[model samples]
Target: MCKKVFILFAIFSFLLFSVVMGNWQVAPSSAEYEYSAGDSFTVALTLNGDGNDIDALGFDLTYPGSLLNFRRAYFEGTLLDSWMFKQTQLLSEGVLRIAGFTISGAINSGTAGKLINLVFEVKATASDEGYIFPNSFTDDLAGATGDTAIFRVKPLGYSVIGYIWYFSNHLPVPNVSISLANYLNTTSTSGEFSFDLIPEGDYVIKPEKINDIGGSVSPFDASYILRYAVGLTQLSPSQLIAGDVSGNGSVSPFDASYILQYSVGLIESFPVSRDWFFLPSEFPLDDANWNSAPDSISLSPLDSDTSGLDFKGIVMGDVTGNWNGGLKKQTAAFVSYRIEAPHQLSQTKIEIPLKLNFNQATLAWLVKVRYQAVGSKFLSAEVLGKSENCIFVSHEKNGIINLAFASPEPLGNQQIMVSLYFEKENSLSDKFPKIEICKARLNETLAQIINLRENDEFQASSFQLLQNYPNPFNPETLIEFSLKKQGYTTLQIYNTAGQLIKTLISGPMDAGNHQSLWDGRDEIGNLVASGIYFYKLKSAEFHLVKKMLLVR
Candidate 1:
């Protein structure tokens, strides 16, 4: 019901926007040409928009009827190809009205598309300022069930300016020779050059300098390409700036040096996916966004180039430019954790493996862990390795724990970010630490995360017994527990009626975490029946009992 209401509200909002804001638009904004009287041209009208659904539309267009003649309307490739009701009639000498609809119930959507082609014949000489105006338009259907959005009426007018510029040193290249159809001129000091007062025609402009080989204009190749040129040390001022090697705007000796490295095969070029951009690290900027156009390529020291996940589940660092904090960003999608054998009813230490998909050096990060336990008390946590000093108390609530840790410096040079260690005290039998990410700021505000396994490594903090892994033993199973002090311990199994079934251990045990094995057999070497059973650990001062299952 709520979903239905939300959908209704959405439809209502769309209708409101269409009725109030009117987002429909027309494209090409402007065009230009010099035509003699009687010359005719075709102007394709494209319906531009922000993708609102609409079935019917009507608009009033005002043009200079004396200067141009509007031929019969064409809808060969328009949304109104099968208009239920179509009208294209002149309301007055200079005003034309248009109305169209889709009886098949199609709606206009997407960026924009051709709606119609207007064939205009120059009736007589007309000023270049003549235009087509979407004076007013009504966007609606028969009822309010449809959607409409705010739209801007775009006007197409005549244009007559033509120019292009080349840039250098973050400024326009001045005095550069440019030519078109044997017409020649040098750019102004401001780096701008243009053609003006010319009759209407399409033209291509070219910039030229003394003969120089042209190759891919990429930073990764510029250095080598320039190095292989005839004169290694001397290039024309134009050639020097043309390389734009560093892309810092001006030509510099460093550009030549970079080329030499590439030419010698000392460095290689690579490509990155287009959907990435870089901003300063001082403030956390945009989220992960990628483009396909590709960004500039450059060379870097080989040592800082390793990143991604490794065999041990540790996150490798992103050494590339911190695109979306790739260097420090963690891939939350593949992120997961594992638990080693715990201390068995004692203090357990959880190892949080930090994994990554990329890294160049040590990646710095901060993580807030929120964890809760049913049979354990939340205890202190340690930031593994050199990053241990970065841990600080953040927050805590109920039985859950939150810990914050940051690196004093970037950590990926060694390839793996440090691991995290968490301790839980007085945990119940077989209870593993339950942890989650409250917050993770990789590279300050850019990064991924660590995976925490359900069963993790732990150190026994008190005398306690833990449930056995692979229980319901067929042949045998291991029962692990812990002791705080050295003592004589007895481990016995019994059936439902409290009858002794088997004794696995009846001797001295070490004062630390330990384990025992149990096979599904009674003292007489007879197979036990498939049923419920209980295991009890008894010492002079401590005793605990837990249930288990047996199968024949």
Candidate 2:
């Protein structure tokens, strides 16, 4: 009876001690992993002791047999480094058994650390699921003797995705270079980019692209920068970089001046060395050193599949953010205007006045003039009258003239804005010079140029009446005609039914080209309804009629 009681008491003590010790578990460094086929990787086996000392530990690890090739096991820099006995074996095609024990002393209580490292190489592609699992765990620790510990291993791949866009319009910028470590990718036409099979770690991403810096820089951009300098507006971080055309690390009115000069071709390049700049979409605008921050992006400790790593692209002088990779669309249609030069076939030098006929006020304008005739030299140009308040710049090169002007205050209407002087070679006396306005801007909208001629193409002996400008009129239109000799002229507007509505001119005129403005009205000044109408020019030697339309 005493032997029976002793054995039962010992068994009870062992069961109580086991209940107090709890279970010991071994797990991988990460619960999940990502790798492509033919890529090599490492997995660390860590020991987690539940306040229990361990002298020996062993486990059977199972992996995807067909997809992974087992390399070798490492035990350096681990809790079992001083173990007297350590062994690792490939028990089966996909099963590895590893064990280690220290005979020198106990591994110590509450010791939790890495036990071994398992190396592997992916052989084939497979669906995402459990790739490595602890099939069995055993340890020579008191109390946790037959308890099963849960173990899991997942292998989900990782990717980095992002987009690039224009800072001004938020339009996609394609073909931009995006880099991650040693990997590189170019954005698609949709401005989307991605890098697959990336490992989990810290990285810095960068973007780069270079393009012709023409047509994207304009006076509007300078105006935007000026507004920002005066605290009248705000600009994004990327926009600030674009506004720093002088490369002085800050934006100022002087930068605006430089940008304006570049827009008008007064300066061939910006003081900034680059034609384009970029910033991460997630860049902190409120950072104290944001103005001096690097252009690249940082992904500190990227540990998962990351996305939405977008970037903003800026043209160096496009502070208003209106660059669309040189494919900008017009905001408004072109409105045609004419500038007539004085008929001078006898002089070798002449001054042409650039008079604009408009009732509305203008804040900015840019005009590009091209001289079609050879040997005609443009001497100088100057702003006159109210236009003198504007910042004006003009550059003439290779028979092309670029004029850019901006005013803080509105320029009044119906005035001569500039005067251009030119000298012609006497050898080309018989051939008339033709001046064409290649491009023109009034405010922010594009304007059309019509009838940029010295005089009418007809002979001096013939009387002529030209068609009215903007034949489909609104509330006004211009009537132009030429007289072979001085005489009394009557220009009358009549209804389509041949009844006279109003007489625009009834007086003696000189023998030259003439123009008259016809407001859409009757003789009493009442606005007429929308319809087709005719105008007749009757003189002693010329009689002609033309049709026009007016829409209210």
**Candidate 1: tens digits of C-alpha lDDT, residues 86-136:** 778888876777788776755545546666666766676434345555556
Candidate 1's TM-score reads 0.26
State the C-alpha lDDT per candidate.
0.49, 0.72
TM-scores of the models, in the given order?
Answer: 0.26, 0.41
lDDT tens per residue, model 2, 170-289 = 878888888889999999867899998676678998888876454778899889988888899998766777888899888889999998788787988888878777778777664256
Clashes of each: 57, 2
Candidate 2 — which pairs collide? Answer: 18-143, 168-321
- Top of the candidates by lDDT: 2
Cα shift from native, residue 505, model 2 (Å) = 47
